[model samples]
Target: MTTPLNCIIVDDEAGAHLVLDHYLKSFSSLTLSASFYNAIEAMEYIHSHPVDLIFLDINMPGVSGMDMLEAMPDPPLVVLTTAYSEYALQSYRYQVVDYLVKPIDLPRFTAAIHKVFRRYRPLTPAQQEGNTAAPPPSSLMLKVDGEVIRVQLDSIMHIQSWGNYVKVYTEQQVYLSPVTTTEIEQKLDKLGFKRIHKSYIISLQHIQKITHGEVHLNSGVILPVGNTYRRDLMEYFR
Candidate 1:
């Protein structure tokens, strides 16, 4: 049998805790290790325990989720939780496994967890050394309106979520489709699209300038840089 993914929840809200608890119980592959109301308590728990994953909340009273991530000596795979869509782009810079908006539903939540398992599961020594056989390529075709648009993996710039739909921004134009941000994020994640804010995903190549808390695209679109994402972006610069 596959090992159950050890997980924890770190959020200040009581509702969030109860909701996450309910969702976690529904997943057979997941095992809850602990839950904390603040980052400090979570940090203490993690220091003395082993965890495979973390469901982290972005906005907190003190020592925000982003700050806690930055201070970790060795961080586990992270899935950011936030109500605001603006923090989506920033979370990608930290190499977070996924991002989930407020009031997360079961279907969306399960998909995010699956993505983490697909990407980070341990590989054998041979596989790690690239001696094992390669996996098949994963591709996604986007349909904009009635036109079938084949977006080659190399051409996508980023994806943004607006209400119930997602706007996939590319070098040429944007493709609006009826999909959740989390759903689109999983599809484009393997191709290098990083969630940098709650509503924006950026192509790392199209980034012209990153200053203050904004990412200036070559197309002149300025995207906000979240406080949590700033450090990771700086590391990429180095």
Candidate 2:
């Protein structure tokens, strides 16, 4: 079995720690090594400890979270948390794994962690030595409500935007994931998925019928085609 990812949280606010703690508890793949109310203290702790990830807050006292990252010559993966949107551009310069706004929801929190997991998945010794017997992945694992759900690619018929979350529709049931339509759109695009509207993405393989302004899936799901996407669909048919 692979080792669990160890991570630390550095934030000045107690409430911030509470929120992160609550979310991290649900992840079986991760374990919280330690948490610090000050970034400086956390920096010192990391020097003598092995941490795979870091959850940091931007607006701290001395030795701000960003400053802490600068101090490390090779900082582990980091995810920035703040109430403001202005630091997003600069956070990229720090090479953070993801950024979360304050009062983080379960879905978005899970998504951010999943991003880190996907990017830094540990390769076994055999795989590291150029093993090629394993087949490519045909499904995705989405963490929903503290449990990881494995979703098959071809089983997805469409996705609908539900407020701040998305409802993924397959033949079995609708699985909700915390993300924007465009986020999932990018993931499924290369896998025979196409954006049909601003709020919907449909799997091309599941589409059974199409009209000028709408498309019907084999599951009897009809979705309206957005004006912006109409031209693309026409060209695709041509």
Candidate 3:
């Protein structure tokens, strides 16, 4: 007999917990290890338990779900559950297994869970010894306003900040988001996106020319490379 996947729910809403609980009861292959209303409590439980999957929420009172995920020593497969769809792109940067919008239907939830299971099947002793492979790169989902947009990493040119919002300039179009520059800076830094200035993070692939302390993008936009970021920018150029 196969072992049931040990799962936990970390959501701030009582209704969300109830909804997930009802759906989980229907799945014979799933076992609820615990449920938490906050990141602190959830962190404590996972440290003591062997959890296989996590149904996490994006926005919480004190510590957000994304924050909690970053703090995990060995993060389990995370499926984000949130009402705010705008955070979809940000969550993808964290390598979350999947993103589920709030008011989740049973069918969709089941399908997502199955996808996770299939994607992360446990390796056998021999396969593990042979060095199990990693999963493929995932396309990021960006929610701008009410629309869901999938942006392939290759199409991205650069990201620029305007006050509280960041505009992602892609080959196809530009996406505006109400997120801080620091937040976008942190997410994109590891994904080959370099901060050339306080206001600009350019995709290293789309940079066409660097001259006079400015970066010329493939799209013909010239962005200033800030003095603070100049040292790293010069190194990347070399």
The root-mean-square deviation over C-alpha atoms between each candidate and the true structure, in angstroms, is 16.4, 15.8, 10.5
Residue 193's C-alpha lDDT in candidate 1?
A: 62
- Model 1 lDDT per residue over 1-238, tens place: 2778889999999999899899999988889989998887686577558788999999987668887786664589999988977988987878899999999988999899888888676657777689455553333455455333456555666677889988877777778977688777776664656778878778787888888789898888898876766777678679
Off by over 4 Å in 1: 123-238
In the range 165-214, model 3's lDDT, one tens digit per residue, is: 88988898889976677876765556778988988889888889899999
Candidate 2 local accuracy as lDDT?
0.82
Error of 3 at 218 (Å): 1.5
Displacement of residue 56 (Cα, Å) in model 3 is 11
User: Whole-model lDDT for model 1 versus the true structure?
Assistant: 0.78
Q: Is candidate 1 or candidate 3 better by lDDT?
A: 3
Question: What is the number of residue pairs that collide in model 3?
Answer: 0
Candidate 1's displacement at residue 31, Å, is 0.4
Which residue pairs collide, candidate 3?
Answer: none
lDDT of each: 0.78, 0.82, 0.82
Cα distance off (Å), candidate 1, residue 87: 1.0
Q: What is the lDDT of residue 172 in candidate 3?
A: 85
